[model samples]
Target chain A: MKKALRTIIFVTTDADAVAAFNAYFNPNEVQISHFTSGMGAIQYVKQIGEADLLILEEHIKPLGAVQTIHYLKDNMNYSGGILFFSDSDKNEIYTDNEAFEVLKKGFEKSDLDRVLGLLSNKKKPVELNSKPYSLSYLINLSEGDDIFIKESIKIFNESVGKRILEIEELFEKEHYKEVSNLAHNIKPSFEMLENNLGSKICDELAHSQVDSSKLEQIKLLRDEYMNVQECLKQDFPELFKRV
Target chain B: MQRILIIEDNPMVVRSLEFKLKKDGYDIVVAEEGRQAMKLLHEEIFDLILTDLMLPFVTGTQIIEHIKKNYPKIPVIVLSTSTQEDIITDAFKMGVDDFITKPFSPSELSLRVKRTLSKL
Candidate 1:
């Protein structure tokens, strides 16, 4: 009998990602567990550190990605393949680990099929879908130079509301530890666009200490981030190129 | 030939960088941690430093700050996948010469290294 290759997947939305994975990933080689909650995922990885593959997501805590992955690995004494999947796949796509990101975004269904087929048959990388240099979006970015700025703005307009809603929910649930993490996660895109106002708001909300103060900071910051996004959409149509 | 130091844990990235720099006729040295990197600075002088931000025991920023405080002439460039603003700003505050996001082209990296070396 073939040995089972255990996989611990910290997932949030199934929409199509789970289905895609299920369609692929050999049953004999892959035994996978999905976690809807971030804390629960961490607990499982801690209690059972036998996973051979780890799929992480940024939905649980906004910017808790690098920190969470490191912490989980440290606590569990787990060292294996790691993949990060984020629903917020607007413009940012990891290049070095681009193949994994491709899988996470449900982009390369055929490659995933090949991976499953190889794993099921106990094949090596020789027969699998091998990429020449991890598939990166920088290649895409060069082509999308004209559209990149506009597309970025559109993504900002669409995601800002959802980001604020998520943060508010986290606050309501008293996930105080995650406030800064979430802000940090969102701050990058804002900073990349030189959105100083939005960046400042995220910075303040991330570091606030008191209860009411934190809430107030979040509320004020959320508005600022949102307003900057909207104003960019309206005020600077020439520079931002709103879609 | 200019003295160059690489502080990165990932062997693949290091090897890739080494190939590009060597082809350009620059002398290079590499280290994986902050403390070991600091030790190398004591023995040989480097014109430029290319470092990754996230590292075990010793961080890229710590190394950059050490170089700035003691050597002052060597310029440090931070290479990271991390997009955190504070980390980027902190590196500059500690006197980092340039910051580049990860998955950069080896040619582009080589060009930046040349530019930094020329500046010194």
Candidate 2:
């Protein structure tokens, strides 16, 4: 059997879209981290590291997909793949040759499938221990009203619940390697739920908080996450339907 | 508080305007792309529009056209990095109230915001 390749992926879209995307990419080794919005994606990637691929929508309302792409590519130093989607364009906005080229060329949509194929072609199966992390989902989910975004929290809280426990066990083992890898992997999970404790845990793993100070920070973060888990379990048991 | 809509792409420029305008107590809404800027107008009414010439998704000119056709009550000012005569004339023809270029002092943005808000 071929050894699996370890890679990081970041995505932003609706919860349903995210769930669908996971079936396709099957990211990381042990767990999968997912995100919801463009800002949340940018923050997660900037704080952690580069993602192997970025699956985005071409027509996210309120914040145009192209403009957010500008912010991500320009400010974040993202070298990941860019995948975009748009609803059947009612206006036929890109019918003009000039418009088509700008959309196709500037956004680098041309290189998409090839990137995906190459990623999939990596042949090695995913690491059983790899986790998917993405936070952009929260930002994307938080449109229209607070209810929509809150729904994202409820959904992601469930998705990441068990994995949080598994990682906590790994962390207690002083398995710094696993902790660092898992931290980098699940950074998106903490972000989508706005689980500040999860963020602090991932932050230390993602960044340079090595000594005693970082350890204490992680412990504090773990406590906070325990509270967040309780809150999520008690509130909104049904969770919002995916869009 | 008067409502102002700013459609600009560059963050540095956006932050600069945001800083000065907030100090003046204006309720500001921002859009980095023309398409997004237009969507905002559909829901909220702004007193004045301070737009840039170039934007992603939809151009600044498109914004002017949409606003002209729909929200004629709102005055518009074009504060962009472009000073091309055709751009100016076109914007003016589209009913943009004023056109100013960037590298301008903070006072200039304050003045233009004041002028446009005052005229409205």
Candidate 3:
């Protein structure tokens, strides 16, 4: 017996887009459900409880593409891939770990096929390495100046260390706004250390709405910082001694 | 020596900027926040301003507006994250001289500073 076809939720009011999608996808491989508004598409997905992918147009009634994606991902916990259709001239959309891909309007069939292939492939779980931080960025910025590197490391230890403590305290006090600002302020430190997990947490903490999840994020950041600091201390025994 | 004022709250970034620009032969003065930056602007005459958009106490936008009005001759360069496209656009509209994205190359910043100063 043939396997069930994968369902795709295409959200758009454009007749041309629907026709293009219908023409490109093989009926045997996938089934397409069309909706004119974000709300309608969202309702359909909620009712079905799952979809293989969601294709969103840049403009739609009731809610825009971004809002729809957020509602689906954040509120509904939708796990399917998302393809956003946007104008060629608009600012590119970036998400942490690239949760969605963007295809410019009037995209060719080949582009659609490529994106579909990518979306269908399951991403491999990223292996966490032993060392989650690096000094390469700082080293390069220093241009082999040991003094600058040492000073920067010291500054990171003093400032970032203190900020992490403050973030935890603020979160405990339920000062979510201050917690967010502190996260925003220290984001560059993680970027400098080349710590992706820490950076992503900071981005989430900075942008996401206030919630209990923030405390969990703060703990993660704190643990990561401690790990990085421990490694740094081991690597630079003399520096730690000086401190 | 041409002097530049860096108005940023990030110590790491401030250190990098200070290290690079000072090596490039420009005198550097640092302000850890926007209010201090505004006060420093009045007390000193700088050739250029390097500021971050998000700041404590005051904002880069307010500082830029003040510069355009009071110190129009001193060209301003903004330091922003790549994700802040809309805010960067507003900075340009407000008459900033140029912008360097965070995690920016020190060499590129040196060149931009040199170029911005040359145009004056």
Per-model interface RMSD values are 13.1, 16.5, 8.1
Leading candidate by DockQ: 3
lDDT of each residue in A1-243, candidate 1, tens digit only: 122353435354453565556545645456445544444455545433434455666555543556556566567655555556665555344533433442345558675664455344532221221211111121122212324434455555556557678878888888865665566545544544445566666766655553545777777767776666565655447755535
In terms of docking quality, how is candidate 1 classified?
incorrect
Native-to-model Cα distance after best TM-score fit, residue A236 in candidate 1, in Å = 51
True contacts kept of each: 0.00, 0.00, 0.69
- The number of the candidate with the highest TM-score is 3
Q: Per-residue lDDT tens digits of candidate 2, residues B55-88?
A: 6578789889999999999999886533256788
- lDDT by residue for model 1 (B2-68), tens: 8889997654345446655785798989997778898999998888888887665776777777888
TM-score of 2: 0.34
DockQ, cand. 1? 0.01
Q: Rate the local accuracy (lDDT) of all candidates.
A: 0.59, 0.57, 0.78
Question: Across residues B3-96, which tens digit of lDDT does each residue of candidate 3 receive?
Answer: 9999999899899899988978999999999899999999998999999999998988999999999999999999987778999999999999
List the TM values for chain B, per candidate.
0.92, 0.93, 0.98
The candidate scoring highest on lDDT is: 3
Residue pairs in clash, model 1: none
Comparing 2 with 3 on TM-score, the higher-scoring candidate is: 3
